[model samples]
Target: MASTPIIATLLKGMAMGAADVVPGVSGGTIAFITGIYERLLAALKSFTPAALLVLKREGWRPFWAYVDATFLCALFGGILLSIATLAHGIEFALAEYPLQVWGFFSGLILASTIYIGRQLHWRALVVLVAFCVGALAAIWLGSVKPVNIPINTLTIFAAGAIAICAMILPGISGSFLLLIMGVYPVIIAAVTEFNLKLLLTFMGGCVVGLLLFSHLLHWFLQRYRQPTLAFLCGVLAGSLSIVWPWKHAVVTVVDRHGETVPLVQRNLMPWDYESITGVSSAWPGVLTLFVVAVVMVFALEYGARRLQLKRAANAA
Candidate 1:
C-alpha cells in the first residue's frame, strides 16, 4: 500500500511530462486524472513563513519538517527524468501517425474539458468573461505559427520559466506556449539531439520558472481560487482549436542549418466527416484505445484518492 502511492505518483508525473512534450495536450490533465490535483496545488503552496524563518535562522530539520519536502522531490524527479527518456518516443510516434496520436489526445482533452467545465461554479460576470478570455486566448495560441528566435542562456531560462507554468495549468500546453514564444523547436531539437549548450540554457530557464511560478501559483490558489479556476476552465474549453485532428502546411522552408520545416494552418480534423475515408478512420482499434485511456484516467483518479485517504489515516 505504501509502495502503491509512490508508484502511482511517479507514473502520473511521467504521463504528465509526456503530455507536456506533446503539442496540444496538458500535463495538468494527467495530474488531475492521477488524483493529485489538490495535493499538487497544496505541495506548491507549501512555502510558509515558518519555513522561510527556519531556513534563515538555522537548521535543515526544521525546514524539512515545515515543508512536505519528500513528495515534491520525488514528484519533480519523476517529471524531469520522464521528460528526458520518454519524450523521444512520443515525438517519434507523433511523426508517424500524427493523426491517430493527436486523436487520442483530442479525446483526452475532450473528457478533461467536460470534467473541468462542470467544476466551474461561477456567479460573477467578470469572472465569467475572464474564462472566455482565457479559452479564446488558447484557441488563438493553437492557430499561431511557431516562430524562430535567437537562442541564448538567459532567454532560454526565461522560456523555461514561462513554459513550465503553462505545463501545470490545465488548458495551456507548455510546448505550444514555447512555440508561440519562438523556442519550441529549438528546445525540442536540443533535447532530442543532445545539444548540451541548448539543453542547459533551456533547463536553467525551466528551473527558474518552476521555482518562481510555483510560489506565484501557490499565492493564486490561496487568494484568487475561484477566478483562477474559472480561467483554467475557459482554457480547457478554448484549446480544442489546436487539438483538432487535421492541419495543412501553409509553406515549407529550410531553417538556419538547412533543415526543412513545415509551416501549418489549422484544418478540420477528418476534413469532411461526411466523407470519412476508410484510410483515416480504419482503425476500429482506436475506439478500444480511447476507452482504455479514459478508464485509465478514471482509475488513476480513484486510486490516488484512496491512497491519499490511507496516507492521512496513517499520519493521524
Candidate 2:
C-alpha cells in the first residue's frame, strides 16, 4: 500500500467514481478489485476524535501523515473530477445504449465475483453460509420496488446516509438505493445544477454514515477475512441481476424535469426482450461488450499480479 504510486491511486479513484455513477455498479467493488479496499477503509476509520488530539499535540505535518491525508486528497480529488466530467456522458450512454452499458457492467461484476471468490477459503462452512446470506440479501435489495416520496431536507439527508453505506459495500449501489428511496433524481439535479445547500446536506450525511459504518466493516475484515471475502463475492454474484443487460421497465415515474423513467424493471432474456418490449434486443452488440468487459477484468488482474511480483522481487 505504501509503495503504490499516487497516480495509480488517482486512477483507481476515478474508476470508483465512474462505477458509482452507474445505478447497479458499486464503487466498493472497484476499490476491492484494485487492491485498496482495506487501505481505503482504514483511512476512513481514522477520523475519530483521537485524530484531533494528534493534530493538537503533534501539529499539522504529523497529523497529516498520521491520517494519510495526502492519499485521501489525491483519491477524492480524482473522484470529484471524474464525477464532474463523466456524469452527463454516462447518463447519455445509459439513455442511448442501455443494453451495451448494462451488459458491460454485468460482465464486470460477474468477473469480479469469480476473482474474489477464488481468494476465499470456501471449504469452511461459516464462509459458505456467509456467502449465501450475502447473496440472498443482495437479491432482495435488487428486487425492491422504487418508492416516490416527497423530497425534503430530512429525506435527502437520510437517503444520503443509507446510500453511502451501501455505496461502500462491494455488491450494493448507493445510486440504486437512492432510486429506491426516490431521491436519485433530486441528487443528480443538485449535482448538475450546483445546488450548494442540498449538496452540503447530502455530503454531511455521507460523512456521518462513512464514519459510523467503516469501523464495523474494518472489524469484520480483520477478524473474519475469508468469510468477509466470501460474503463480498456473493454480493457481487447477486448484483448481476441488477445490471443484467436485458430489462424492461415494469413501473415508471415522472421526475421534476417531467421525464418519465424506469422506477422498476424486470430482467428478460435476449430473445424475449424484443418480443415483449418491441425494441431490438441488439443481442450481438451487448454480448460483444460483455465479453470485452470480462476480458478487461482478467487482463487487469494479470497486470496487477505481475506488478506485485516485480515489486516483491525488487524488495527481496
- Residues 30-83 of candidate 1 have per-residue lDDT tens digits of 776665666776666567576788878877876765565666666777887787
- Show pairs that collide, candidate 2: none
lDDT of all the models against the reference?
Answer: 0.73, 0.87
Supply the global lDDT for candidate 2: 0.87
Clashing pairs in 1: 157-205, 161-209
- Candidate 2 lDDT, tens digit per residue, 199-313? 9999889888988998889999999889888888888999998899888899887866788978678889998999999999998999999999899888889988999899889
In candidate 1, position 30 carries an lDDT of 75
**Model 1 ranges off by over 4 Å:** 1-4, 45-52, 56-58, 122-127, 271-288, 305-316
